[model samples]
Target: MVNILEFIIRSKALYTTWIYYKPNRLLFDVGEGISAALGNKIYSIEKLFITHSHVDHIAGLWGFINTRNNAMGSREKDLEIYYPKGSKNIEDYLNFIKKMNKYLRFKLYIKEVEHGDIIPLKNNRCLKIFKTRHTPGEKSIGFQIIEKRKRLKPEYRNFSGKEIKEIILENGKDEVLEEYEKKIITISGDSLPISPDIIEDSDTLVHECTFIKESDRKLRNHTSLDEIKKLLTYISPKRVILYHISSRYNRLINKAEKELTESFKNIEFHIVHPEEISII
Candidate 1:
């Protein structure tokens, strides 16, 4: 069976929580305010992938922990959190949460992830964490969830099912009988003009676009519409989700959406608002 993957774009700030099942279920990047509240009701999130330690990105970390604890005995597994190495005071953050929730029953396992590390999941799927250009002060990382597939080997491409089965039985388990394939979904945290290579040919690319006009090019640490336009030359993502818009541009969402759709006809661009959920 194929896995079920869903990305929920909750409130502002590069906050997106992803739920993927087929393997174990996991959530990524809990943002500030009501985003975590919405995530609490979705699933028993067992794993969390954090991009960075920014306040807007990690503010809901404590709330999520508290919500899991309040579930009584419903949580049957430990919650594991993956964050970039040398990013921030992770130890202190964990200690503070533990101190605040003294009566919590479940265990929270915090793991430090490095660039190019693969986090194994159930059903042979894995998440590959790659370094990003965002948040240079602290080590920031991007996530790519990879789904593994097996196809008949080139030599057996024209063979019948029975023949394939026969070969599988004749050959040992260690024999390579098929070709492997991977489908990657990459998400970029808040960054200024991330390289298109980071998200090249991704099934879906979720990126932050804080500014929509060319005059806003001077803004630091945020991507502008011009920057995203430049990326289109190198990246051909099937779906392009623009998120983390500043509250000041709330009224201009429709205008931005229309302009983007007119500019990029081959790709679908979606503007994510607070409490809005999008499945990719």
Candidate 2:
């Protein structure tokens, strides 16, 4: 299953944060340098989920869209860019891009999503949007890739496949099955510490740990390592990848990671170093 598979690619992050989930061919953000860093790999991106319209998080939008339009060997797949509803920044940016890139070869979809909105993906999967406390009144959001499935309800748990088939023939599949959702990936786009409930049971969480020390955080809307420590107490994802670190902490990240690795023994921890490409 694609959910059980893992393939880390040479992707970029940092002041500009974006995570490419290879299995889904989805890009989280389109920060500057993303097109250059991902190079030809950018062509594979079918969907982009923008958490917010901050310049660093979306500066590369034009480059990506234009590249796909003019670059050789580009696929004609429709590219969907999802952002929080009422994001004036994104709204204006898209309007400008649409006028500038008028003779595009493929479809460029710009969608505005609100909290609790679900965007469908391939193979019974979807991207679920939720609110995040980032810049006040900025309508920032987070995303989770979930797989929807139907499983046998408790009352039908004891039945064999043949028995279930016989029962389905008499009744219906809906009578025997119950819908459930499994979290595949949770992405905390540039935001303050997110609520644990939003990311609960996620297989992998890509969160922003912008500041290692609380004092270093000049902005209250960004996340800090201290909050992540507290978050770890309740939220236990299979893996955690931290990104969007401030460049000032570039030299200290290794030591900080060493200490964190020693403290958190169960969950895998990864940091996307400042101004460098990191894959997980």
Candidate 3:
């Protein structure tokens, strides 16, 4: 059985948005209040994957960088950050951060990433990036965690235990087993409903639900609960976490969650209330 992921997430449209994936010490989008939310744990983050340069999504990055440099924690650890390639806004902001902290204590590494870039991680896992649609003129992307797995080949699956043992002993285990990729998680950084084709085989999906009511959204850049419902019909994941929500529907979250649970019986639903931090 797959283990449930542990995460700390907060998203309030045009205010702040961030997610801390505990298992990998990975922080996605360094929005405002991140330093306060994570406290000293901010030093534990080894890498950061940014989706875009929106102020609400990356406002606290300077605080984050400064805190780690002076905070009372592990100070020598190097920090690596990856942002969407060709994001001139992000580049300019990063340059400002460097100038502000001229006497930094630790090393800071930054990279510009584009679609199809694969960042290898420990435990046979990798982080893959893909493009996402957001505000016009703003470059954005999404992330997926994929794992390498081995399973019995199709031709050997129906064999009896004894037969399989004999075949393995004769031909070696590698001959009967095949390698495959399993998408562990998918995070849709602030965007309209992401494509179902990308999240089809993923176990967990962390998507933005900016407008609970489709009628409330005037711009086509964000997604709504109704659109998410339609998207879920195309791909079924074990869990769906809705974040980057607008504060207007704070009182209606429970009702929406209840409805989705009834509709997607086999999938777990988690909504990150915009007013508070959500730990799951």
Candidate 4:
């Protein structure tokens, strides 16, 4: 069985958004209060992926850097932060962080990436980047975790166990098996509407549902429940998690949850309410 500890917390639509994935020791979008929320768990994180330069998505960098530098723990581990290539806002903030927090104990590396960039991780896992529509001019993106696995080819599937062993011994295991990619998780960071191809086959998909009603969707960069339903029609994920929800719907959360539960009965749907954490 695969062991993964995924934690997500957001405070309404304008507050913060952060997701900590413990299995890989990675954090996605370090919004405000992340260090306080995660506490000592922050030490386990070795990498951070920033989906955009929005204040709500990156406000935690200030405290996170300081916490890691002064906290009681192993400070030798390198923390790599990746952001979109052309986000000037993120670049400026990172530079400001460098100046403010000089002479750090641990090594901090910041990289800029564009669409189609593949970031390799430990244990044959990788992060695939793709473009997203958040702000019209700002550069935003989404991420997908892919695990490379070896599987028996179709031609060898019908062979018996003994036959497979014999075939492997003669022709080598590489000849009978092929390596394929399995999408483990996908994160659509504060996107308006994402393509099905990005998260279609993923085991777990975390998408933003900023508005529950279409009339509440006044911003062009935010997503709505209407759009999410449309995406669900073409793609089926093992788990669908909703985050970055607006606080305006706080009073109607229970009703909306029950309604969505009945509508999407076939799949598991998780909602991260305002100022709350959801673990999957």
Top TM-score hit: 3
For model 1, the superposed segments whose C-alpha errors exceed 4 Å read 1-5, 14-24, 34-36, 39-43, 154-177, 274-280
Instruction: Spell out the clash pairs found in candidate 1.
Output: none
* Residue-pair clashes, model 3: 0
What ranges in model 2 sit over 4 Å off? 1-14, 150-152, 156-177
lDDT of 2: 0.83
User: Please, what is the TM-score per model?
Assistant: 0.82, 0.88, 0.96, 0.95
Error of 1 at 178 (Å): 3.0
TM-score of candidate 4 to 2 decimals: 0.95
lDDT of 4 at 88: 92
Each candidate: what lDDT?
0.70, 0.83, 0.94, 0.87
Q: Give the root-mean-square deviation of each candidate in angstroms.
A: 3.8, 3.1, 1.7, 1.8
Q: Put down candidate 4 lDDT per residue, 46-135, tens digits, no spaces.
A: 999999988999999999999988888776778999999988999999999999999899899889999999999988999999999988
Sort the predicted structures by lDDT, highest score first: 3, 4, 2, 1
| lDDT at position 132, candidate 4 | 93
- What's the number of clashes in each of the models? 0, 0, 0, 0
Candidate 4, which segments miss by more than 4 Å at Cα?
1-4
Q: Candidate 3's residue-wise lDDT over 190-262, tens digit each?
A: 8888899999999999999999998999989999999999999999999999999999999999999999999
lDDT score for residue 71 of model 1 = 55
